[model samples]
Target: MINKMEAKHLDFYYKDTQALFNINLPVEKNAVTALIGPSGCGKSTFLRTLNRMNDVIEKTKVVGEVLMDNKNIYDPDVDPVELRKKVGMVFQQPNPFPISIFDNIAYGPRIHGIKNKQKLQELVESSLKSAALWDEVKDRLHDSALGLSGGQQQRLVIARVLAVEPEMILMDEPASALDPISTSKLEELVRELKNNYTIVIVTHNMQQAARISDYTSFFLNGKLIEYDQTNIIFTAPREKQTEDYITGRFG
Candidate 1:
């Protein structure tokens, strides 16, 4: 299988506390790989490591490698800013900038120096369409993004990411805050996004993982307990710990 990114013997530390241990995982191109685990199981920590998001934390150190296109992203020469552009992130909360919806999608491209109004307009339209929110917000592009619903806000955040033309999207419980209908819509957007961008998501919702991910990695206490196809992991996990967690016996 072709991999877009891989973590090789990756370990992370926050000061003296090691939050991740020897995480070896592969992210396939244009596919969804779900990181599933209970709270505090290092899923989010591992997600942040992919694009060096952990670097922002004071006294945090990453050892070993997180390779994107076979180059170690943690290398001293790699620009974190550029890396972030290629590996966009979405948090659990919908954090619109309180600006116009059009401006929110235009923010990243603007920072990267796209000055033509026509180009920015096209990008904003396409990005919104990519996130499947264009029809709802087409006439309201000039409206404040905060005026949108939670689901719309989250999709706006995603459109903002897409405007930068990222190769991979990392989502940390991207639907956790929404109601069932909103969550379903977000999930459908995710399934569609994988057709264009590699997706790595960390979710506490096991059923969500089962529904949307092509592959799954089960993490526990800072270690990967199992990694396999979603169907296999869900139906026939090789590890007993993985089975227990999926079966809801213990976290």
Candidate 2:
């Protein structure tokens, strides 16, 4: 499998406190990789480093390399905005714009200088369809996005990210706010999306990680303990800490 992204010796600090230590991970192209750990374990922090999302915080510093396409994304000359366009994020909660459904999907494309009405319309339709949300919202394209159910809203948020045609999709507990049915649907969507987009998901649900991920990484106390195929990690992890965590002994 081809590695589309890789992190080497990644360490992160917030103000004077260190949050992540010497982390290395290789993300396979067109595959879903799950980051599993307890809260405050640096999964989200490491996820943000891929697209420089952590740069938004004050007095933060990242040491080491996050590379995509063999180029370090942390290089000073790299444009984080453009990198973010290539690598989009889906948050834990659905945060659709308080605008029409069509507008929500078209928002990214519109900002990227796609103004032609027909083109925007086509983009909206394709993105929504790709996110598996088109049929449900096709008729209500002009309706406020806030009116959609939580599940629909989350899918719509994914569609919004899709409009930009990203190469990588980073999700942070994307289904944590949804119902069981919604979570199931989202898992299906993740399976489908991996055919075209490399996905890295940070999830608290062990069953979820097992259900949808091709690879799983176990983190504890801000360090990566083990990373392997989902089957290996869950069935026969090499490390006792990993096995313990997977078996519900301790996190």
Candidate 3:
């Protein structure tokens, strides 16, 4: 399988405290890879490292490499802003920009120099459709995003990310705050999206990981305990720690 992203011996530190240790993995293209672990096990921290989201923290440092398309993203010549545009992120919470639903989806294209009104409309429509949110909000394009339900807002945030046309999407506990029905919708979206975009999702819900991910990586205490096909990871995990965690022995 072709890899869309990779991390090699990656270690992350926040000032004097370290978070991730010597991580190495390949993120396959057009597939979903799930990261699972207890809170603060470095799952989210490792996710942030992919697009240099950790760079915003003061006195933080990354050691080793994170490569995209075989090019090291951590190279001194790389521009984080441009890199992020190609590797969009969906946060744990739906954070729409307190604007009209249409404008929220159009924001990325407009920022990237797409000035034509017709073009913006087309992009917004396509993006919203891609995010599975078009039908509900198509007529209310001018409506404030905050007026929508939590689930719609989350999908809008996803549509906003899709508007940028990124090759990969990183989600950090994306459905954690949604109702069961909404979470189901988001999972369906994630499964469908993997057909065209590489995806890495950090999720606490084991069932969610099993249902949507092609591969699963188990992390513990800032270290990778196991990585394998989802079926094997959940059914016959090789590591004792992984098995224990998956079998309700311990976190």
Candidate 4:
């Protein structure tokens, strides 16, 4: 499998404090890769670097190479806005737009200059269907998105991301805020979506990581401790820190 994204000697700092250290990993194309570690271990920081999301934070400095599809994302010529369009993100919380569900999914295409009603409708329908939310919300496309349940809202967010037709999807604890059933549904959606889009998820739930990820990276104290196949990382990690964390002995 070809690598969809790669990090080389990644280091991040916020003012005087360093958050990541010499991190290196490869994200496979059309696969689910999970970043698992204790809180504040820089997993989310690393995920944000993929699409330069950290650029918005004040006093944040990044020194490393984040390569997506053979192009260095941090290069001076790289357009952050275009990068973001190619690499979409889904936050931990389900933050649906305060508008009609159809409009929420149509927003991205509209921004990209697609204004035809039929085309927008097709994009909305396909995106929602891809995110496994079409049947539930098809009749209510014009309903307020805020009225949906948490899980539905989350799926709506996923559909919105999909409508943009991103090549890669970054999920920062996509299901962490949801209940078990919702989480399960999200996991199923991730599994289904991986056949088309490369997925990188930052999650603290080891069980969820083990359940859904094809690859897993373990981080500790702003450093990458181990990265390998998910099953091997869970069953018999080469690093003691990884073993301890996965076995629940320690973070």
Best by lDDT: 1
Model 1, clash count? 0
lDDT of 1 by residue, 1-251 (tens): 89999999999999999999999999999999999998999999999999889888899988889889999998889999999999999999999997999999999999999999999999999999999999999998999999999999999999999999999999999999999999999999999999999999999899999999999999999999899999999999999999999999983
- For each candidate, give its TM-score against the true structure: 0.99, 0.99, 0.99, 0.99
Candidate 4 accuracy as TM-score: 0.99
Give stretches of model 3 more than 4 Å off: none
Question: Taking the tens digit of each residue's C-alpha lDDT, what string does model 2 give over 1-251?
Answer: 89999999999999999999999999999999999988888999999999999999999999999999899998989999999999999999999999999999889998999999999999999999999999998998999999999999999999999999999999999999999999999999999999999999999999999999999999888899999999999899999999888888983
Local accuracy of candidate 4 as per-residue lDDT tens digits, 117-167: 999999999999999999999999999999999999999999999999999
lDDT over C-alpha atoms for residue 145 of model 2: 99
Give Cα-based local distance difference scores for all models.
0.96, 0.95, 0.95, 0.95
Clash counts per candidate, in order, are 0, 0, 0, 0
Q: Which stretches of candidate 2 lie over 4 Å from their true place?
A: none
Worst 10 residues of 2 by lDDT: 242-251
The C-alpha local distance difference test score for the whole of candidate 4 amounts to 0.95
Clashing pairs in 1: none
